[model samples]
Target: MKSNVYMFLLGTMCLLLLSCGEEKLPKPRAMLRLNYPAPVYEDLDMDCSYTVKKNKMVQIKNAKYTRPCWYNMYYPDLKATVYLSHYEIKNNLDSLLRDAQNLTMEHHIKADGIKNKEHINEEEKVYGTLYIVSGNAASPYQFYVTDSIKHFVSGSVYFDARPNYDSILPAANYLQNDLMHFMETIQWKN
Candidate 1:
């Protein structure tokens, strides 16, 4: 009789422990809202113009605008498109490239706690570099600087979901190449 009672108590305790374990699982949180620059496309008819910042690294010559689409699976319910901000001259293009390098490095360091993957590609243009970051939950962000137009352009695609803490390389390359294309299309207004 005692042996049977002991076995019963042990089984009951095991059942209770299993129930408690299930209750301890974490619940999923709500998606975070992403924040980025509000795109300014005042000149939709003619190519949009961008003003040179104090650095004079690049100026907006003209940009072709396209409405962002929902087809992009990585970034659901968010809008995104290529912006072609052009610049003139190559005098400070080298400095712009250097700045891009520093900016990318800082971004990587900051994201080290999360998803952080990056690659740098040069020789695609006469004097330019493209940086790409990709990952599972995050969309890629790109930066491209060029000596041909003295321009450094940056762009990124982000999603409503928390980016996967891995695989940040694809988005990085996408944005960088797009910026380089924009620089290539720039025409000097002066």
Candidate 2:
């Protein structure tokens, strides 16, 4: 029995020596590597007052409401959607702009910071602002494009999962570029 106990201790000592050879390391924190396909954009085929280019990977569907011209541009693989709403400007441009701005401001409570980038294409008559919200906000990006006379269109992006800025950063970034492309390609039918 003493010899068996000694053998067991010897085996444990061998394992401990072998395991201690390499100084242990808490693995350096690693972030997820997310890869998305290169975006191929084409004019979004829709019967609306204006047309814009959209990423081919996006699936456009009507919003879940009765409002006309409201759409949800869904990215199935990313599990994210860009909600879009169109309104006709009829002496309510100020209110429309305010509403769009207010929507973005709503996320301020949870956002680390908000950056507004103005978009202006005088030739296309598209003038707007893109609001990029950082941190764990429900919506990471929002924008409103308007001719400032006849039409106003606003959009916001939301992911299906809970907001975790670090986890969703890559996908949010890809969608940001896509949204910018959408804004750049707007052409009013009227």
Number of the top TM-score candidate? 2
Clashes (candidate 1): 19
Alpha-carbon TM-score of each model against the true structure: 0.36, 0.87
Q: What's model 2's TM-score?
A: 0.87
Candidate 2 lDDT over 68-150, as tens digits, reads 88999999989999999999999999999999999899999999999998999999899999999999999999999999999
> What are the per-residue Cα lDDT tens digits for candidate 1 across 1-190?
9999999999999998877754565878765544433323222223322322111122233233442211121222233333333344458766655665665555554354333233333443334344444334243454443335433444444544455634334333433443444434433232
Please give the CA lDDT of all the candidate structures: 0.41, 0.94
Candidate 1 regions with alpha-carbon error over 4 angstroms: 1-86, 110-127, 134-139, 145-152, 160-162, 166-190
Number of clashing pairs per prediction, in order: 19, 0
lDDT of 2: 0.94
Count clashing pairs, candidate 2: 0
